[model samples]
Target: MTVLTKPWIWSCVAAAVAYALILGLTSGRGAGELAYAALSFGAFAAIVGLGQMLVITLGPGNVDLSVPATMTLAATLALKAMGTDPGTAMLGLVIALFVGFGVGIANYALIYFLRLPPIIATLAASLVYQSLAIWSNRGLRIKPPSGLADFATGRFLGLPNVAWVGLFLAIVVWVVLERSVWGRWLLATGQNMRAARLAGVPVELVRALTYISVAVFSALTGYLLASFSGGAALNMGAEYLLMSIAVVVVGGSSIAGGNSNVPGVWGAALFMFLVVSMLNSYGAGAGVRNVLTGTIIIGIVIAASTRRVRA
Candidate 1:
């Protein structure tokens, strides 16, 4: 019971249960294979989810709707630049991060200067970013550099290399949020913007940095995903917009903000992958899978919210 109250725990439990059911149906076959697949695919969700978690932690109304577009644009540009080169992974990465930074700055400018709501600002910016992506490559699928592709698709120490990167990032984020002054300021800002400003928390700066961080995360994911998938596609990142938010929310981050769960985000990422696989094993179609996934996400979010209010 004590453990259950920890917001991150439930996601892990759900994942375990889903895996168990899937194995039961197959009479315990493919256990390792399923686990590997979940980690491999879930890494992207976890990376973006961590970024989204930070934005949401700044409170309600703060989110990046431009993630998919950012990913698409960054990947498109990075892949185009790298273009079958052998040692240009670093170049592609630099392009990706730069694109992310620019997008983040653009997002912040819209919110701060235009005084627009974050949702409206980001949603509007997404169109521009998407157009930029479409314009940059004109729907061409550019393959990543061979070395970059190998690193993205390769494994290490018995786990997917991408999963290792995700885990490392999760650790870094957890440390920053748990141990840094910036983390304190962010929490204060999220709890009450006016009060935090009164307390000299640099609320605006916090907001700016948070938005930038999320954009960078989205871009990095875009770069890696493009590499992993063999090329950059116009729609490679389309699925992750909702996925990033869902993982954050279902991981027990407070929807109203001021609270975050790094571990929960990763757990929720794994759960997302496992649940989909389980649904497929049970013969659920794509629509049914989506409906069930949405239902589960809503249920968990509601449960976490109610618990938070009660506590």
Candidate 2:
């Protein structure tokens, strides 16, 4: 079918297939439980993936490598700020968002003023961010406030609270990118920065804002994760660095830039988690899982690229 040709559709299909495979290995209500787990974990990936997709839409050679560091540092400071106070959820959230803002501005400043490539700037900044997190965390685990923890881990209408947050962000982002004037400017800028500038688009401002937005998104994920997991570990966001970019690419967002799809990101996020679960059920080792996952990603990229070429 024509619709099946959509790149994003594949992730959804894969997720379904993975779910079936897992179900085949078990009986009873395991299916529902597995699905719930997938949604709960996938939400984090989807949230960060949406942010990465925005920055990536800005064009090639543009990506935020500091997501994990941003997450770690923000969560560290936020948890520390709340200090397990009973009603300090908002305080912690604001602290986390503030940290994200600073990191975003710092990343852009490095790129704009120092003329550094995004990869280099974000990577360099990540080292500093990570150091800060280490110093602030001091190899200790700080618990999230009780209410915030419950809200993070709680469920709503048979779906995870975190999943609801992810869905909400996805909706907002989809609306902004698909319907707003600023979205048009972002797309135009991504398509051709020089042309966009000549046409009166504020390219510089767009870049700054995009960078900032990605960091803020990452920070939010970090805060929720710290709460959900009970504490923010120094390496809490390490795996998400790859997961963020992976979901973007797998969800049909163009790696080259100027194109994105939000539904695909969520689908891809679910698929990612399901695939790991399937592998685990089949007794695959971590190394084997990594190899297989990498292979799958490479194959998908090649297939997508060939299709684009044919089109």
Per candidate, the number of residue pairs that clash is 0, 0
Candidate 1 lDDT over residue span 1-311, tens digit each: 56667788778878888999999999998999999999999999999999999999998799899999999999999989988788989999999999999999999999999999999999999999999999999979988877888899899988999999999999999988999999989888888999999998989999999999999999999999999999989998899999999999899998789999999999999999999989999999999999998888777777766666666
State which candidate has the highest TM-score: 1
C-alpha lDDT values of all predictions:
0.92, 0.91
In candidate 2, position 9 carries an lDDT of 75
Each prediction's TM-score against the native?
0.97, 0.96
Query: Residue pairs in steric clash, candidate 2?
Result: none
Q: What is the lDDT of residue 177 in candidate 1?
A: 92
